[model samples]
Target: TPTTIPYVYAAEEDRCAPRHDVLIPSRMRFTGSTSFSVNVFNISLAGFACDALLQIHRGTRCWLTLPGLGALEASVVHHNNEGLGCAFENMLNPAVLDRYVAHYPVPETEELEA
Candidate 1:
């Protein structure tokens, strides 16, 4: 199996957020209930990335519903053939995101631990 990167991808300026694909539903509710199947490509302290079939225009506001994380308000920061980058505008529960991150733990080795 391929190893997963723990850190979120970022540009040099760290302005735009990065993304990834989880193929899981980041259930969203903006105009209505839309379940989008996406993989979280990257994540930062601010936002994350996911494969979106919908063309997410810049500055578009949407809600994200994680499996256990509940819902969060997010905005489209960037989009391309890869996916849409979104920044968390309002988190229904911060702990939800926290727990999700914690669930995907990167193994610690002696050299890395040192």
Candidate 2:
């Protein structure tokens, strides 16, 4: 059986903000690491989940640059072998999140793991 990597200590009930599924290309820079391209598969006012090939640990500071937006600051809250979940230092604007959902549509036929 595959070992499950536990996320940071927040309980499931703590995730009250709605999550929007999207497949948007963006840039991310982890502290002490250079910027790289990343695919933000899901997002919310508080955080986002993205594809991260690099090995990262919890509490890693990072900045994500979404299309048409400045780099949104966040910290790595959790990570598994394939991806990372990051919490924003400041909540994202709801209006911006709405625009992103409108711009990027994850093809319903394409089933994303996250």
Candidate 3:
């Protein structure tokens, strides 16, 4: 089993609203309104650590897409009062991940893991 890595970072003073996107996957069930709040936090070459406000249970398989990055499949690996944590089902888009890394460079040390 892939190890679940806890995201380690400081919460921004401003809520830094997460970008929302509509997702339509044929494999998954959905109602009239289907969307999820995606937080792009602590992104790395391996994967990104995000918190999602989704009505999905753990182990649920779904596809995710960001503004610059295209759609990719993912599985629900973690869920808590905070939100959901999912390891990208595949290696992240390197180009997109690189851009994010350039923008939100990791600090010298990891902040308290959330």
Which structure among the candidates has the greatest TM-score? 2
Clashes of 3: 0
> Model 3, residue 25: displacement in angstroms?
20
Off by over 4 Å in 3: 1-33, 104-114
lDDT of 2 by residue, 1-114 (tens): 976543333422388578888889999997788889999989988888899866677777899999989998888887786588888878888899899989987877656443
User: Could you tell me every candidate's TM-score relative to the true structure?
Assistant: 0.59, 0.82, 0.52
Error of 1 at 17 (Å): 8.4
Q: What is the lDDT of residue 62 in candidate 1?
A: 75
Candidate 3 TM-score over all chains jointly: 0.52
Instruction: State model 3's lDDT.
Output: 0.47
lDDT score of residue 51 within candidate 1: 71
Model 3 residue 47 CA deviation (Å) reads 3.3
The models' CA-based lDDT, in order, is 0.58, 0.81, 0.47
lDDT assessment of candidate 2: 0.81
